[model samples]
Target chain A: MNLPPLVQTFVLHFGEMGSRWGINRTVGQIYALLYLSKEPLNAEDIVERIGVSRSNVSMGLKELQAWNLVRLQHKPGDRRDYFATPDDIWQIVRTLVEERKKREIDPTMTLLREVLMQEPASAEERHAQERMREMHDLFELLTGWYADVQRLDTERLVQLLTLGAKVQKILEMKDRLFLVPGSKKSRRDDAKDK
Target chain B: MNLPPLVQTFVLHFGEMGSRWGINRTVGQIYALLYLSKEPLNAEDIVERIGVSRSNVSMGLKELQAWNLVRLQHKPGDRRDYFATPDDIWQIVRTLVEERKKREIDPTMTLLREVLMQEPASAEERHAQERMREMHDLFELLTGWYADVQRLDTERLVQLLTLGAKVQKILEMKDRLFLVPGSKKSRRDDAKDK
Candidate 1:
């Protein structure tokens, strides 16, 4: 169960980065190993590769499953449980975004809304409420946009992303062509559209 | 230096949420206090209100400054430093995104790129490299989009956000009117744009 040097480096780095991403080192390492694994990996495989306690591996796998970042499978002839990451990376990204929004963003939004419901008893409370309202609006808008984009097919999303800064142009064009009526544009501008 | 119940609730919730967001509780509490404060708060005020040690408050303030979530200010004839969050919530959002990208995303991208450069010594390494490439490409596209959006003026950004799912309509309209040639649409459709 020895990992190759490259795998080891990648896993170790991910393990370090995991804390900053809000997961523990072992969870990150386990996810990295499963993600890079050519075949489904069993708990024994993870235990040997990561050198963590059996219970620790069990807990890490559970956390990953909860995050929807890992899936449990069984080998045709094997009795033990196996784990693997989804083959599609885009799905993985979507799952990460969804889970994080659920865990981190949603609660804050809820709290802000609750706080906003309270009557301001003082000037300080009023100012704080104003700030909270601003935050609530921003989060709501951003999350709403994310939800819209999340509905897009992966290919269309990729196309949109590949357009990158060109999207600003599309936004501009939408403003110019549709917002203004009968404004004459050069043929070059027409060609630049979309 | 007792915090009102409302502020206490917000601060405590943020402290609880902080670890999940990859910051320590003290730092989260400190930032929450500063963010809601009507005037700049010195370290002593923070320590008293949050009920943490002076050293902990000092460390948390330092961490918040590093994250660009807090700024230092000075009162006339006062040598002690005071801290406050930016008045504009949008600016705070921009700063948060920028700092998180620097601390978390950028290094991971750099590591993934480095790993991609190495020659895969085996099939296993090759599979790992492939996964790494997918991840690297995803991060690159996302960061690139963020960079483009970051250049937008706050008003433009807010307008774009407020558009939310309507943006998809603009995208579709662009395809219809611009991508397809000589397609006639009603003026009502034109008004619906942007």
Candidate 2:
């Protein structure tokens, strides 16, 4: 519970930004604490440091586990369950994005699809469908591209991101190469996907 | 206020997903209504349709305006203000990303930078600082790449995303091209050997 001042400052800042991050104060604080800790921590440690009720820590851990943001571990000869953020920082980022898409985007995409399935009975409804269609298409492309980028290994992902806008020039080059007659079909297909 | 079943379903669904999106329920519902509306809607129209108190709609509108997600308009011969989402859906997406980064990411980045500047007083704090450094570096990469991608016009963004993992192959090709005696890509990258 006696966190160094540096760690404590981060925990407090995270708690303040909790609502903005779509988590409660205790949840954000707990995650931040675990994120900065060198080792796993039990509920007692969280409650003591965060100064929240035991039940608040329990609930925060439950929500965090549900989001796959925290992992549970058992110490040798110790019965208390300990929690830690995933060790791979990039994995944490990937999990955050995937979990968020599952919660916020997938549901809206479903709703948009369901609504689009309905027949519009009025001009207003028809106009509404146009907007929904635009949303649906945008989400489809975005999610598809996200999945593609998400599947890469952390090194590859970092490379892709570091490449930045240079990727656009590469795509143009690929197109020009494809213009050549009798280009390798299998290579073309491979580059086109996966 | 008399929304067709299709539109109403989306409104309700979006409201349900509001907390997940880091917005209040009424704010989500209001945005959904405005997003699908053919014309700008006044507060009365929002209250009547959303079935919330006038004050609730007013607060929701105020929050939306603060987030820059909604635009305020004045009607000829009407004293009441009207609200509508940006007409360009891509622009709306950009605004949401920019606003969220400003509110949620920028502050955290500042905190991380400040905390990182402090000297660690103990071994535990040194380990914690390592974790913080990793996070700081990851965020620096992500935010930098995001800014690069964000600066591109929508057409270019779509092209870059649509290119998908093919971007990796292009990088490899560029590397090989630079491997020639007088290559252009700078031979120093050969050490990466990725």
Candidate 3:
């Protein structure tokens, strides 16, 4: 309740967003506090800052830890555990993406694969399989692309994201030069001195 | 309840996934049915297929329509309303992304900007604002990239996605050939015949 004004506003907004997403509002508030803090905060600090019950703070911190959204720390000679968000913002984004894929996309893909394995006994079943195939293919492409992007280091990710649509030129160039491997046009280009 | 076995399995999976995400299971089942069906299905058809009550089917359709996840139709002779998912799977993906951005992302960005405008009266406030800036900038980069990708037609999107990390070469190429304006090294590369 007595957070810095700016931090209070950010925490309140996240609290609202969390409830809208069916997450406990306290979880988001707890995360917002940790994210803005320069130092780790213990459960008592979180409960006092956010005006929540001790039990709620405990539950929220536990949920955040489950999501890999926070790191728990213990100071020397201190009995209480403290929490902090990952220092790098990009690391947070990466974790969110990874968790979403694991929770939502992977399960759907698995279900689609299971149904795709079933033999179509009727015309309707055949049509349903076709639809599932389309869904599965789209997930495959997106997940595959994400997996590739995820492997890149954070610096490389920033470069890739900043490139955005400009990469279209590269795709076009690749098709022209590499698609027709060993074409005369491709040969002339790398030779440059001609 | 009497849907083809494959269709039933697909619908059941979506229902489970929907409930997991706090969406109504019936809504997911209805969508699954329509997504697989070759022809538009009336509300009664959904009720019969999913074994839900008429009112639940009506409400589910309304929910789907609200999310822009389904198309409403009317048979020329029948008075009952009918529904179907958008035909192209990519179009469905685009709609889901747009709706999520509208519901979840846009509001958070607005709130972040609002807090960013507040005058920082203390070091704590300043540090909080700096963290906000990092989150805001990351959102900017992601939204910008997505906006660029969204504008591309499906063909270009597929091409872009299929390129995947291989585009790292292009990023390097861009930095080498196009990043600096009018450098001698770049000039030599572009003026191939010289």
Which candidate should be chosen as best, given lDDT against the real structure?
Answer: 2
Once fitted onto the true fold, the runs of candidate 1 whose alpha carbons sit more than 4 angstroms away are A180-194, B180-194
Docking class of 3: acceptable
Q: Score the docking of each candidate (DockQ).
A: 0.40, 0.55, 0.43
Best by TM-score: 1
How much is the TM-score of the A chain of model 3? 0.89
A1-194, model 2: which lDDT tens digit per residue? 56789999888888989988789888999999999998899999888888889998999999999999999999999999999998899999999999989988998898888889989999999999999999999999899889888887787788888877767677666667655555655544434554
Ten-residue stretch with the least lDDT total in model 2 chain A: A185-194
Model 3 C-alpha lDDT per residue in residues A149-183, reported as the tens digit of each score:
99888877876676677666566566665556677
Per-residue CA lDDT of model 3 for B1-194, tens digit only, reads 87888888889988988865647899989988999999999988888889989999989888888889999888889898878898999999999998888888899999998888889999999999999999999999999988988887787798778878877776666557554675756543442221
**What are the models' TM-scores?**
0.91, 0.90, 0.90
User: Higher DockQ: candidate 1 or 2?
Assistant: 2
* Ten contiguous residues minimizing lDDT sum, candidate 1 chain B: B185-194
- Which residue pairs in model 2 clash with each other? none
Cα lDDT for residue B133, candidate 2: 90
Pairs with steric clashes in candidate 3: none
Q: Which ten residues in a row have the lowest lDDT in candidate 3 chain A?
A: A185-194
Let me know the TM-score candidate 1 reaches against the reference structure.
Answer: 0.91
Look at candidate 2 and tell me the lDDT of residue B58.
Answer: 95
